[model samples]
Target chain A: MENPYIVEPAAITSIRQETDETKTYTLKFVERERTLQFTPGQFNMISLLGVGEGAFSITSSPLQKDDFEHTIRLVGNLTRAIDRLAQGDIVGVRGPYGTGWPIDSAKGKDIFIIAGGVGLAPLRGLINLIIERRNDFGVVEIMYGSRKPDELVFTSEYDKWRAAPNISLFLTVDEVPEGFEWTHGRGVVTNLLGLSKIDPANALAFVCGPEIMMRFVARSLTIRGLAEENIFVSLERRMECGMAKCGRCMLGRAYICTDGPVFSYPEVRSLPQNLLAASF
Target chain B: MVKSTPRALKLENLNILIDAVSQKYRTYGPVAKDGENAWEEVKADGELSLGCAATMLPAKHILQPVRLDLYSFKSSGGFQIEEPGFDEKIALFGVSPCDVNAILALDRVFGGRFVDPYYWQRRENALIVASNCTESAEESFCTSWDTGPELYSDYDLLITELADGYLLEVGSQRGKVVVNGLNLPGATQEDLKEKASRLDAARAATKKRLPVPPDDLHQLFEERYDHPIWVPNAEVCFSCGNCTFSCPTCFCFDIRDEVKPSRKEGVRNLEWDSCQLLEFAEVAHHANFRRLRIDRFKHRTIHKLSWMKQQYGLTGCVGCGRCVRWCPSWPVRRGRITSLADPVEIIADMLEPPEKVEGVERPGGVIV
Candidate 1:
């Protein structure tokens, strides 16, 4: 019997500091025979053995089979333990669990990707897939934001993504540092939605960030003539067993672990308001 | 597979059946536990109490234990994972009809899209021996849910009490194995007629009525999602989690890893969890989804009565009434305490329109 509880050990080959509070670990499955084929938006339950486990979105695309990456923010006990690990350290890995982004369904449509802070991690895979099949999609637009210019992740990859044909990239910071020589707009990411030139009716928008940010961006897109069904948002909930069995991640009827991490605005509109509230 | 002809066992031969079943498997039945009846391991015939009104805890603990080791890991040269093994062949004796239904509901949850291998392993190795309820217990509403007094299916063996002796019906091949050497006589048409009347009397004895029919809950609850009843009712709730702990079909759990003092090895455990707890939906960053007590209170009932059916095609509650009996905060009305967790009262109140306050002006300063 395949015990779903078992975590396969993966060796971290390298680590890159994305920000002061977050790092991206590049790992390869210890057993070379194993394949980590994960779709965009699907998350892996990464475990730092003897410490704890957490569910993180698989940032590296399935297009690269040999090595996968998880961009982790230093938040809780498990993530903090993960951040302390050096290169060549082995961490237990399980999953590629939960439903992924509707890549196949959104094909041939203009794709609008909106992300904030480290929330861009999950959408990174989807963006890569879209760029790989560049011709398959219409004009692709990505608007990413961070608290400050220094907090942004994947800074080096921004230029490469912008260089792609028919793709426009926009970056924003909530508060620009005084000493930083930043040239981009400074405000909440939703402020960029009005400047984005994509026709909302023709585009499928994917938004992941703070719940408040996602709500505002979703509202902006809807106001810009995007259907509620066309706008997607990723929900962040407390999950123990990434499987729905652990009810900690319940969003009314839906278990955020299995039913979503990704849900359309219309799908979540019926859910209780407290799930997406900025604070109690 | 129900019996074409039920079997009969003399009153004195009850021990013979217990001995026959326990010879091959560990038998468990309702037994005295700290002044209350509970499911416990029974070795002797005298330890079995088949007629106990209701066990404090449902027999679900046999399959889904309170603290289950999901998996354990060791750090030798590299990491090796070990899954917990379950191979105990056990037979649960004297299970109530509602509890049996609860097991069936749990089967749908753990057996849905991703089959819970651990739960199924225990379920596969276990046998069920159901005992009929001759009279409905206080606070029980099994009759309202079609889950008490008699069971239609899913039992290995069902024992129906009669005036003289017990009518034993074999519902599966495993049941046949249990009764093979007992030399019990085949039940006659007269015994079947007597059994039907007894079940009918027991069903009539149950007075509790569900506020809404199971079929109409989906539509009714969808309309009452924002009903005002949720606020004041939940305000008095202690959020103690007694309702969930005592619930038969509540399968919410929390996963955690516990390491040894040496910090070399650890086991990931899935502990039974309750949605009523404030931290149930709290994330690491301190953002709680169901932070308000009212939301948690509403979540428990909605998940059980409405959402579980939509998700798994089976109701999460089996009308066992354990939550009602075990709740510490249930208010007494006319010297009779009614469960606040009762779907009957909760839904009835939600269906009614909110009381109109006369003197207070509306938020916009508009008064009706």
Candidate 2:
């Protein structure tokens, strides 16, 4: 079998700081012929060689892949190393692996995207893909919540999304700082469900965020009449191999690495694991 | 078309054959100490322990080591992927037929799905020489699973100890090549029939049996998906994963990348993994799907009996009884088969004995 751990070197062309701790890095392969081919919601394992290797989702849309983007939060040792990297620095990349969002099936359906904190990284790729092909999709509604006003990511893109026709964007924060003025929805992301006028029967929901937030979002959508299979959630697990050969990412007999990083609430419920619970 | 005969070689010749095989391959066999049993690489003829019941560790280690480096890389744009370098050929001497069957079970697992090239390469290059059981062990229950002390298709050579010498039977083409290359005496038709009869008697000698029917295990486990039996049965589990690591057919592994201090280079390693671990089903956001110990415990059993069969067309458990022997919990025991619902009667089926058999003969006919 071919070794799946092999990584090609890629250079960081630009770095955009999304929040205080998260930054989106645009990487172009050092060898021009070897551009990364990945689905929108799939992730890559990035390594700093001596630092360590960590899994990061591809935040850039597959529809536009002149250069790939990975939005990394300064969390662990590998992410900390990534944060210190400047433009022109080289990093090792492997994958574009795991299952991505079922965008083709979601076509013509009213899309409800719910994201929290850095969990929005993977969903951002789907959102961008939908916006590029705006007419192909039904009503697009984005409801995002962060820990604080300053913690919200993609501040620059928010204006562009708001300007788009037939799209609705609603933002929320747990607490607004002293100097910050907020005019959008307040409290949690799930609380904004009442604001959505789209029909749940004709809509597909994509949720990514903390386990608690996703559980609430999925439950609320299901109660609102969306089928369990129509509500998709992005799951995260510590994965070493993007292939099913590694047992680390298994949810019962299903290897999340191969079967899903994306799954419907019904499939997740059938799994023996308690993924819906706030505390695993 | 005369029946192949069985012949005996003096104990001294057996030693010479082992030495010759060791020169070409990494030879392994059962070695007994005063306190423990182990399978280790034999450097000389004196280390072989044909009388031991079973090695504390299964032969799975030879094909899949406890830890193996899959690939290594350097940040300086240098990378290296390592494949199993089994050029030295392998000879497993004194392996019991049960253990040989265990190896066959592992072959189905690793060779079945994804075709683990690493395991396939080592298994294809290695050779197995199994010894017939003179006496059954207390834990021996291979007969219950229809794979036992008698014989199966995994071995290259099967050796039975006779009154004056050792009777060898060539099983495969590989065995024929080795036997043809060795110097040994020929056997008569009567000698071969005698060995076959003795093997049949030994197979019947094993009294212990797993109570559950092998074919009905899928339905039994599936029907009892929510049974309370799992809770009490799994209560004593330590979740240490010792059972999985020692099992012959447990091929589940985890892949990890270990980087050098320079942070620019690393090697990805394939390490043995256990489903018993809490993090096995953990996803992003620190959520564990099968977080409860009871759930994890039941999940493994169900997978072995039901899910694995659905995916691979074979039962995950080969009835090796390693897990029953190694588990620290006092409640666990080999052949302690339990059904989710009411137990069904187990019917034992007997097969007719074979008429003719071929015995192995070494070339150049040098006894010792």
Candidate 3:
């Protein structure tokens, strides 16, 4: 068998700018093959022929297989190249790598989602997935925060999320702009956690955001009576190879690429290496 | 066991053997420098430096190149993923037994679990010719680790300098193939016995030892998880990752894709990576795990001594002392062994923990 580094062609069908710096690209199988099968939270290694390759989480749920979505922010070289791509442009994609959110275990349980900035991309997949099977889950709440109102992503779908009876959507921003009409909470995303009426004793929380933001959010949840193990946070590491071989993404013996991009707060806390405050 | 007599070969005859091997293999051997020795690829027997103690770098470069192109791709949606192709065999000559054992240890790692095909390809087609050490260097501690100046099954042949020429012992089929073709004198029983005695004396002469016993290494590290020793000792770590790069047993790497300027062609490359690097554990949202220099330093030691043992049934460190010698930091100096704490005390604490320790509580809510 060939090594997993093999690249296959993927065609971009549409592009939607989520924010000034972040965009969501929709890709379809150019060969007309069956839709790509991947769970929410899993990512793909996207290659722009002469530019470079980067790992981006699938922003679309597994339930939607006809097409897939990748939410990318203009951060470095490869991402900048991807940001320049237009509809019908061809790029190389490998994998639906890494483990996804555990939905089966979330059945009949209340789902609490907390996101910050572009961290919402992966959580958006889970939200859409849960919404599709709305009756299968109990009270669903989403608390999302951005640096500013203009930075909020998926603005087109906010209205639909607000109208859903089974879900409660709470949005927050760090600061309000002059002459801007804002009705939602205006503090950190963790501040919106107080507006939801779910019982922490029976709810599972999934959080993704800036490291500092996630730390505070986790602390808030713990103080609110949520178990440390009940809170899962997605970690972003400098992953060159999304395989276990590369020691780049290692936290002790566990490789983030193979073991997890998602880990419980207690698990992360136990690793002495995981709690270090400086850049790795 | 079928014991073969040791035979002698002149330096000239040895050169011919190397030349013949180089015809079909990439030959690597020791090269003498300004009163020192280093291992490198040699094209002829004249380049062999049998008198050298050890190579500056371990032989890992043969199996795991510093930089390797994993795959290449072109525009028009066409690409090619590179596969492991060991077209040329390898002949490693004048390797110390310690270095040979280091490769064997690496074999247990890269050859199992994920089974690195690239390493395996090179390994399958390679031959190891180890040299029996006549003297030990000041920093050498292979004897303490049970890896020594003598030979093992991992080598294809074992060579020792004799009174007039060199003693050659065929260690494998490949060694026998080379020995049968060499125009040299056959050996007698006395020559075999004398060679054995010389090897035994070399083993006995080794004086260096690791401060900590290998058996107690795991528990020692576990107990020292919060010990102050790591903090003070690791303060000097520069995090340059030179220690890992020069280590024979360290096989960590990073995979990346590089594209041509025209955006039409690209290649996936695998480069040597080290956990000592600051970004080794930084995640997507810029959360760096193992951020502190102390944490990174502790990780390298813990992984080599504890984590690798648990995962692979063998310690990751091969007692090569490269990390100790290569680290630029003062406190990070190599070969300074520290004794392990008692295992019984550690186990007792775990079993007899305080009933009311602060900040220790079970969760009362659902776990994700």
The DockQ leader among the candidates is: 1
Candidate 2's residue-wise lDDT over B1-368, tens digit each?
13333333323246766776677678887777666667888876566767425777777888787788765665554333344344557888887766676676567666543466677777888878788776666555666666566664567777876655677777676766766657666655666666677767666766656556677666555445554444444555677777677666566776666866665556667788888887676654555656677776766666654566565565555555666666666542224543221111111100111122112222211211
Best by lDDT: 1
- RMSD to the native, candidate 3? 7.1
> Candidate 1 at B279: error in angstroms?
2.5
Question: Of models 1 and 3, which has the larger TM-score?
Answer: 1
Kindly list the per-residue Cα lDDT of model 1 for residues B111-175, writing each as its tens digit. 86667888888888788989888888767888777888788788888888888887888888788
| Per-residue lDDT of candidate 3, residues B1-368 (tens digit) | 34444334433246766776677678888876676566678877457766324666777888788888776666664444444455778888888777777787677766544566677778888887788786666556676566676765566777776665567766777777776766666666666667678777776766656565777767766655655444444554577888788777787877666766775666767888888887766654565656677677767777776676675676666555666566666431224442121112222222333442233343211111
Q: Which is the leading candidate under TM-score?
A: 1
Error of 2 at B264 (Å): 6.2
| DockQ for all candidate structures vs. native | 0.66, 0.28, 0.31
Please, what are the lDDT tens digits per residue for candidate 3 over residues A1-280?
Answer: 3456666778899999888999999987665586778777778878775666677899987898788999999877778788888998887787777777777778898989999999999889899888888898899899999989999998898887777767999999999999999998898888898788999888899888877788888889989998888888887767765765666666766667766777777766655455322221
- DockQ of candidate 2 relative to the true structure: 0.28
Task: Give stretches of model 1 more than 4 Å off.
Answer: A273-280, B1-13, B51-53, B332-337, B356-368
Tell me which of candidates 1 and 2 scores higher on TM-score.
1
Q: How does residue B177 of candidate 3 score in lDDT?
A: 79
